[model samples]
Target: MQSVVPSPEGLAWAQRLVRLDTVSEHSNLELIETIADHLRTLGVPLRLTRDESGRKANLFATLGAPRPGGVILSGHTDTVPWDGQVWSEDPLSGSVHDGRLWGRGSADMKGFIGLVVARTRAWLEADLPLPLHYAFSYDEEVGCFGVRHLIADLKDAGIAPAACIVGEPTQMLPALAHKGVHRWRCCVKGRAAHSSLAPRAVNAIEAAARLVTVVADMGERWRREGPFQHGFDVPHSTAAVGVIAGGIADNIVPADCRFNYEFRELPGSDAQAMQAEVRAAAAALEPAMQAVDPATGFAFEPICSIPAFSADADEPAVRLARRLAGGGETTLVAFGTEAGLFQRAGISTVVCGPGSIAQAHQADEYVTLEQLARCEAFLDGLRRPAAAC
Candidate 1:
């Protein structure tokens, strides 16, 4: 396909958003409020669904008449931190160079958000057959927390969109399926003692290491076994421990150890079953631990969960997205997105947007002007009423 010049207003909006730092650890209210203020100027009615702290929020707005069966264009406001990444220029510069707009969220999602907002004027002026809704969420880079509140609020208000398009760096291609994300933290409690007397005292790090071995075994089993789904980069489900912390000194037996682990499972895989296996392994270890001390055992805490998503091939939303994206074959992704949550809420959904996932969360993250132009064309196509939608 030939490259097209991206909309000047859209590029400006993308740059404006990329300039703002809405890293996952920080509150995204500044970015949310910025977009809210712009929407207010367009006379669009919107609601702010704020988290309990009131520092972060999700913005849900309608561009046409207030009614059900609207089409939702969704994007997350928060981004992963660029702390350790080495970049030649400022990560938040939002600079336009080499036919690309560069910044922290230029590819991860803010590019799609900005372009969507830039098209508000045209969407507002057109006699749209159906409403166009904007659902900008926060904390997606962490675990897709903000969209839950937004969806609940929509339920309370009885606002149901006919379909949803999650702009999650799919390179302008519509995605039909993706893996689920489930994370947990395990804490082992033992009795501290001198390293020389470790035989009498329970060793937390050692016990935790045993459990970690079990986790690793389970992952290896899955890797070597069946239950694979084609199309995903890792067709089989995967498990891995990410963070671990324990002993302060090698001369002492540490009483506490904690580790975080996650499972990325296929759509039909039972994540709970996988978790149960780990819990059972922990239980088997508890007897040996309790023999040493009554207080010794394992505690599991859930960290985050995002369900797997698989859209029906004949669904109106899938058809609409593929058509808007210029009739490309639908694909599957290994990454998790809010698409599953939206689908669970009974809204036909697909993941489709500008940019490449490879550039997301990387140094000098960027979205090519050509990709943005293609996204703009896709959105323009969406503006025209179609029965498929």
Candidate 2:
């Protein structure tokens, strides 16, 4: 069968969006303005709300009536850092090569967002039966932060959606489930002393090392005996310390040390319980350190926490997604997305979009022309009237 193609205008919009540099650290104001301006030109009504820091913002727009329920097409506006990756092209400069678009956010998200926004315009032009809502958020790369406020606004306004589609690069398949993530930074403080009298000093790095070991052991136990029934490839919640820093030299007892740990919790896993186990282990180590120096202590602070989401394979949203994507079987993923937060807010949500997760957050990230074409067709199907029973 000959395949359908995306609208030329929509493709242009996607390329333009990919060109913007909205890395997680930088403000997404430029992207927001671009979206808002595009919506205005398309005659779609929009509202822009800035976070308190004024560093980021969220854009919400709707077509058709503000009814009790509608479909929300959502995507995050931030991209991960590309600081050290060796890329064939500039990560910020969206370049097209071999029928693929390469850039930082092209696959991880902006590609999906572009398709949705472009389709929204097509929907407006086509006068679809159901309302389509557009929701673009910032800081999703940092843990789904921007969408929280947008969800709150929707709730306060008594707005509800029949279903939500979070386009998080699912290779254009219907993703029914994904794991949650909890990130933390643990800091240990101890007394420093001369190398000649190391026994008199409480080494922060040493304390951090003990904590890391405890976390590793906990991960092993979880893998062996904890809840591991999920269908994911790993089939269990996993934990790891990604980064650690301490000590200036081998001779000196380090006064302060910090490490970042992350937990990928399987669906239904109690994230707090896992974190408590790690905290208890750190606490147990504190007294020994304080024995050498009374001021010694440890602290754990949240970096970010993104909850898990799963939709029943039989759910209407999943069924619709499968149908729209031409009947691929539903699947689960191990990575987290903003879909969980949407589900937590009582919205029936599913993850289905263009591009592959494997290509996300990598050097020369790109989405194939085939994925983009499939996604445009999916959106076109959504705009079609539901068939009568």
Candidate 3:
């Protein structure tokens, strides 16, 4: 089969996708349906999974007839919100300028999705011995949320691919391991009272501040304590509080406050244990608040849990990814992706894709045409029998 490069044609396809504005907050059905219809026309086997309301959808299409072993090319259809970003061109322009595809989803993933779509015809015509599965998902920007159900569906259907390649921006390099991302929301309930009666009032903001301090302290400990993995840029499990909210007047003691925090743990480390530690610290603070009033306490809500992913360099998925993408030392990335969920589902998985993560989810986000060209070559490589590994 001739090479199918991700060029102006592929960029055009990506622009059409970016134009849809499938931000995680909005429904991704539009993007998924369009892709599903295209795949249907190619005579591919399709599985469409949706949320209870049918607002979001995950399209799992098989280019060739399903069989025991094969490779899965996976990407998320949703992009991060760009409500406040300033750009020289329309964010959805998919404009080709200075050798780059300028668009919101170009770097993060839609670029790879476009490349895969561009080569769907080639893949269908070739029909390599090993099957190929395109697992494009939704709400990946929020968390590895939709892919969880998608993987469950695949399991229930007994459609187990031998390996999966998640198209998360990695400059077309193969990422062998990445940290797990765990996020949670904590609420502090306290007694409101006039500022003059400080002794009687249980300050939720103050209590929440203490809890955030605990999170910071734990983060510091991880930085100093050993369990360090050298490959990761941070080289340690990390934690941070991203959002906090509460109260009205400064004169009144805040009755309630909530904060969101997350921990990105190194592979083989216990993020759950660290989360428990934060909860325990919050519990200790509650006793003081409860002393003012029995109703004063703290509550916790889980946002998401994405396990860390690590594959031995010699793993079949990693080997095939390196070979297809051109050999280089496999690296670990700090960001999270659905690859972790895929790995947890018993499918060997690797992270390999176009563009640079630095360009993702920010103003002027774009994927260089050079990178897309490399990705196209990788997709073309899959058409060969050697990609069966």
**Candidate that scores best on lDDT:** 1
Candidate 2 backbone clash number = 0
Off by over 4 Å in 1: 1-3
- Candidate 3 to truth, TM: 0.97
The lDDT for every candidate, in the order shown, is: 0.92, 0.85, 0.88
Clashing pairs in 2: none
lDDT per residue (tens digit) for residues 1-389 in model 1? 66576889999999999999999889898899999999999899999999998889999999887766978999999999988889989999999999899999999898999999999999888877789899999999899999999999999999999999999998898999999999999999999999999988999999999999998998898889948999888889999999999998988999999999999989999999999999999999999899989999999999999999999888978988988898868788889999999999999999999999999989989999999999999998866877335
Model 2 ranges with Cα > 4 A deviation? 387-389
Task: Determine the C-alpha RMSD for candidate 3 after optimal superposition of all C-alphas.
Answer: 1.8
Per-residue CA lDDT of model 3 for 25-103, tens digit only, reads: 8899888888888888878889999988789989998877768879999999989988878888888787777878888
For all predicted structures, in order, the TM-scores are 0.98, 0.96, 0.97
The true-versus-predicted C-alpha distance at residue 186 of model 1, in Å, is 0.3
Model 2 TM-score relative to the real fold:
0.96
Cα deviation of 181, candidate 1, in Å: 0.5
* Pick by lDDT: 1 or 3, better one: 1
Output the better candidate (1/2) by lDDT.
1
